[model samples]
Target: MRLWLAIIVGKICAFASRFFKRGGGSSLPGSLARRIEPHILIRLLEKATPALTSVIITGSNGKTTTARMVAEVLKHSGLRIVWNRSGANMVNGIISALIEKCSIRGRLCADVAVLEVDEANLRHVVADIKPGVILVTNCFRDQLDRYGEVDTTLALIRMALKDAPPGSTLLLNADDPLVASLASGSRCKTMFYGIESLDLTSGYTQDRNTVTDMNANMNMGMNTNMDASDMNASNINASEYLPHDARSCPNCGAYYEYSLITYGHLGKYRCPRCLSSRPAPDFPALNVVAQGAHGFTFAVGFEHDSEYDSIGASLGLPGLYNVYNCLAAIACCLLLGIPKMIIEEGIAKSSSAFGRMETIQIGDRSVLLALVKNPVGFNEVIRTIASEGSNKTLIVCLNDNFADGRDVSWVWDVDMERLSRNPSFIRSIVASGTRAEDIALRLKYAGINQEKICIEPDLDRALELGLRKLAPGETLYVLPTYTAMLEIREHVRRRSHVREFWRA
Candidate 1:
């Protein structure tokens, strides 16, 4: 009776929220419903969705995009997907998504529930909702104040996986040692997906000393005027590297040697001390080619196997990060018996999730909004920007909100030197958010001239300043933290005829 009442109240609240246009209303109703019934999520899932195939995606980075990709593919395959499309990925948010999709009598209409669970909240959610498939996209150092280090984040996920449903298929990133290591303890059926070849030509040096030097530069901050030669940026792709983020073998304390590098700590790596190496991926994205900010194309699967033959796939979303997301989605869909053609169509059709490289056109000007919360992810965004080759107008938004992570120090670890490789290419930069001045200082240190950089803490004013500085028809790239992304996106939506992120 309490559960039914909670469902009724939740449905009413959801209707009111949508009618009033009160944000996305993705989590508030679930919070209220949960309050009415403490075990609302578990009770509702069991009573409502008995045969539902639940896909739980949890990782430090790429969870939202990966989950979105999976949901899109499943939708293309004719399954009704209920996902937290608004990026409200918490305990309450997951419940709210379910409640929003469920009928007044608490009957969920969806065939599959693709959920991107926050790293910390995984344990809380999985303790109740037994997922059919669990995908861990890649583990990177994120939200230092909240998640501490990558190991802490890994430990949290590991604990949650332990509580996951028995016999659940674990779709892991074979390239990410941290993610691959999760399969060691678990008895669940595990399958891996990764890039077989990234086709990186320039600055491709995959050696131990190169990693050591990069880590040294990261530990001891690089000089403000540090040129390309000082950090060996040209020889080894220092900008793509993430210091000591994923060097050490998860099994042993020894450093890893990479045979090939695929941006950050993801690549073919082996530990000399323990002989722990990258697991052979089942769904390998071979011959990967980057198409810059426009996106990339890769052939998935190997040519040898007839049943699992290679098929070409392309993603419209920018960054190799999205490629990883694509691979995870493809792997999950394939495992669920979806046809390769359907997967390709879904991959090609998948749109950016809110601020994950979402491009908005305001009259003649094109605005690209991307969310950057950590060093590795920020470096990839920087890489995508540098790849454009054309002159750039950038608005970097840095917030210290709790959701955006309180410690704004992670900005220091970003490869600003790489972004400033061709300083003349960057026409202007507006540092905006709560820590606008901090990012302005960061850019200044990274060799950006003070004349070209402006500090506007208010997002509205920042957007105005950035758009004003932007030339007509040129792309205005706005890199924002989580909260900053939401704020700036809302501001953009009002100015233009853009749909709400959840609907988009």
Candidate 2:
């Protein structure tokens, strides 16, 4: 009786959400439905199926993008999938997605479920929906106010995996040391994917410096001796540093040696003391090509030679970080028996998931909104901008909202100095939002000319001022934290002639 009532109420809320755009019901009706009757909702869905195959993608950055890719790949394989395209990763969002798709008879119609869940909410969602496969993209410091540190976020994922069903596959980023470390001692089959191309540089000097520090800290903590070979392998070559080597053994306080460093100590590494290194990958990415904004080119590495053999594919998103994301998604999809052609087609046609790399046209100019809440994410955004050949303007908005964390100190860690070097390409810098002054000061300290920097606390005024400076045929790159992105989106929506198309 309660279950029926909950489903009926959920339908009402889902209907209401359509009208009340401001309320979360429209965006996250599942969360509200779960709150109203948790057992009823779960029971209602469970009654329809005895077993389920579910795939969950979680990480600090790229969860939405990876989730979208995974869903696309699965769809290409002819499996019906229910996914949350919105940037909703919480429990309510998951519930809402389910509610939106489920029939009034309470049966889940999809063949599989691919969800991009929040790192913090993984444990809650996993307990309620023990998925068949879990893909962990990478762990970085994000939402410091909500998640104290990267390790805390990692710990949550570890807990969630513990609840996963047996025979479940764990797809992870072998390039990210933190993610690789979590796969240790897992009972599930683990598959890893990362960049194997040696031609790609680690990035700017600041990026190299940060990687060195992370490696050194990892080495020091493990009391490992860094031999000459290790040093040579870890040193930066062609602007980017070496592939990430394991710094320490997660089981023991012993230094790990690395055969290569992918990015920020995320390559193949083995603890000399414990003899533990990255387990051999069941699937890896090969024949890589970094396609700037058009996406990536690579072949999926698999363990078996079946009719659906490995084939090349292209992604539709921008930036190198997304290449890593695509690899992670491909790894999981391969494990699920998704054919190579489908995976390629899905990636080639797929777009970013919401603000990950959403582009909007404001008046005559194009505004690319990239979300940067952490050092790694911000660094990637900076690198993407530097790689673009055209002269562009940057509007960086920082906020200390509860979601963004009060500690704006991470700004210093971000290599804002890179933007300073390419002054000619940067037409102007507009620093705005609650932390507008802080962003301006950081840019100034990084060597951006004071004459070109503008600080506007009011977003509307800032957008107006920033857009005025952009010449015709030029695009404005707007990078903001979470809250700032929402506000910016709202502001963009207010413009009468502009149309906002949410990324899938």
Candidate 3:
């Protein structure tokens, strides 16, 4: 009776939310449903068990995009999918999604359910979902105010893994040391995905300093027989001096040493004392055959593959981060026994999920929506913007709401100086959101032209300012925090007559 009542009430709330135009109300309905029946999600999953393949994508970054890619791959294989696509990653939000898709009788109609779950909500979700496949993208210092430190975030994921079904497949990022560490204690079967080398530098654009740091690290690590072509270390513009999440080895407590340092703390790491190192990837991008404006050409070799396969896929998105996202999705598809050709085709056809480099047109100008929630993510966005040579304007929105992380100090950690490195790369900078001044001041400190820095706390006004500055052929990069991304994307969607993501 409680389960039925919860479902009925949740359905009504969902309907009323859309009717009253009070936003999606994704969590409210689920929250109410949970209150009525504490174990509603578990009960719902039980009803779908044995038939539905539950998959959860969790980590500090790339959850949404990776989940979307998994859905697309599964869909291409002719599997029906029910997923939470609206950036709602919490337990209630996920429950809300299930309520909308599953029959009110509490039975699933789809072959699979792909959920992008929040890191903090891991234990709660795992108790209910017990996903057959869990993909941990990468762990970074994100939402420090909420998670405290990198280890805390990692610990949350480790805890969640406890609830995943035994013998479940864990597709992890081998490049991320922290992400890879989850495999150590797993009762689950684990496969890893990572890149070996690249033909070009990482991010939207390459700063000389970033490139220098990467090459220096690569050169440092090149001392061994590890093939440079196999490592492709020079292809990324990684910062060695930046605050790394893994400074020392978790196993040995020795200074974390690296043979190759990819973007952030991801790369070939080894602890001298314990002989700990990056495990050999099950699926490794052995060589970057080519890197162009279109997409990446990777020589991918699976541990079990007869030989390396060179696949060239064009990206509808930008940034090196997307390249990593592609690798992660391909790994997931491969594990599900999706045919190699199908995986390749699906990745090539994949679009940027929602606001992560989601582009929309506001009149004649193109607005590129990129979500940046942490310094690591934001720095990559800046690099991407710098990659575009000229005729680009930026509108960055920073919100200090609880959802966006109460502490706004992470903005300072973003190396905004990359934006000003190429004078023609950015023409105007508009800072918006509740903390518009803070973001604007951060940019000014990064060396963007003081006169070019504009501020409008109002979303509508900010949109107007940003669009007015763009030329007919130029692009405006709209970078926003979690909450801000949704708000800004909605505003752009309305003006551009595009479907809201939930509707899309």
Candidate 4:
């Protein structure tokens, strides 16, 4: 009876939230519902449709985009999908999504629940719901003050996987050593996905520093199809490319040997002492082609299973990080027995999540919004910005709000120094947010001229200044932390008539 009341109250609150323009009420209603019924999530899951298949996606990065991709593909394939579209990924947010989908009598109307779970909260969600598929994108050093070390994040996720149902499948990233390491202890079935070869220097305009960093880490002599011989460590020092946390193998306390380092310690790696290595990926992305601000096209290889050898896929979202997200989504759909044709079409049709490489038009200028909370994600946004050719206006908003991680020190870990490599690509920089001065300082230290940097603590003023400075035909890239994204995106929506994030 308490659970039933919780559902009724939650639905009413959700309706009021939307009607009053209280910003989606993505967590508040569920939080209130949970207070009334402590085990509301568990009880609600018990009443869920028997045919409903829940998919929980969690990691340091790519959770929103990956979950959005999976949900869009499944929905395109005609399966009803209930997801937290507003980027609310916590336990309360998930409960809110479920409550929104549940009818007045407490019946779930969906066939699949594609949820993006926070790394620390994974254990709680899994305890209540045995997901049909658990997809982990990658684990990196993020929210250190909040989540401690990357190892703790991995351990928390590992603990959750231990509780996963027997029949569930774990789709993991083969490139990330920490993520791939989870398969070793899990009782549930596991599937891995990764990239076989990446050559980003050609066919697109990109951050020369980013491309150089990747190429310097890889053997330039390798052809489009890489082999064991190409894995020789003659290209560059792998340590320089790896994040401070991922330099060593997770299995043993030994330094990892890598044949390739694809941005921040993710790539082909093996441990000599423990004899542990990156497991062969069941679904491998081959011949990845970056389309600048447009996204990527690659071939999905199904070597072990399926009828077709490989299927061509494309995503409208840009960056190499998104390629991994796409692969994880494709792998999850395939595991659920979705047809290859449906998967291909769904991928092509899938769009970016809110504030995740979302583009808005302001008169003749194109403005791109990307949320940056951590080092790896921030660096990828920088790469995307640099990749969009030259003469671009950049606005970087850094907030230390509770949602954005109180510790602003993580900005130092980002590869801001690379921005100095091609000083001409960025026409001007507007530093805005609670920590605007901090970002301005970082850019100055990165060798950007003081003349090009403007510190505007107010987001609205900073956005106006950026647009005023933006030349016709050039793109303005706005990168902000989580809370900052919400604030600035609301402003953009009102001015440009873009759909509200919840509606999108």
Q: What is the C-alpha lDDT of each candidate?
A: 0.81, 0.71, 0.78, 0.82
lDDT of 1 by residue, 1-504 (tens): 898889888888888988898878889999999999999988878865558888898888888888888888889889988998878899989999998888877788988899999999999988687888999988888888887888899999999888887768999999889999999888688989988977544332222233234434333333122346334654544444445577777677777777765667787888878998999998899888766447678888943336558778887876777888888888888877778899889888988776787888999988888889888888778877776555788999999999998989888888786656675778899999999999999988777778988999999999998888777878889999998988898888887889877677
| lDDT tens digits by residue: candidate 2, 1-504 | 655566677878877765565534534567556666877535644864645578888987788888888887787778877877676777777777777777776777787888878888888777566677888888777666687766688888898788776677888887776788777767787777776653343332234433244445445432222222212325412123122223456689687666655454566677778786676665666766655435557676676565435657676665667777888887777778776677778787777766777778876777888898877778778877787564668899998887678888778767676676656866788999899999999988877789889999888788888788888867888898888987886776676333333222
Ranking by TM-score: 1, 4, 3, 2
Cα lDDT tens digits for candidate 4, 151-220: 8988999998888888888999999988898998898999999988787755554433233434433323
Which sections of candidate 2 miss by over 4 Å? 23-28, 49-51, 201-247, 254-259, 272-275, 292-294, 305-309, 496-504
Q: Per-residue CA lDDT of candidate 3, range 1-504, in tens? A: 888899999999989998897777768889899999999888888887457778889998888898898888898889888888877899899999888877878987788899999998988887667677898999988889988999999998998887777858998898888899999887888888887766564333443333233434333532222112222435422243354677677887776666565567777777778887888887788655335444556656663466655444455566667777877877777777778887777877788888777778777778888899998888877766665467578899999999999999988777675676566767888999999999999888766778889999987789889888877977888899999987887788778987767776
lDDT of 1 at 297: 80
The residue ranges of model 4 lying beyond 4 angstroms of the native Cα positions read 204-244, 303-308
| Runs off by more than 4 Å, candidate 1 | 201-241, 302-306
The weakest ten consecutive residues by lDDT in model 4 span: 221-230
- Model 4 TM-score on a 0 to 1 scale: 0.91
Worst 10 residues of 2 by lDDT: 236-245
How large an RMSD does model 3 have? 5.2
Q: Tell me model 3's lDDT, rounded to 2 decimals.
A: 0.78
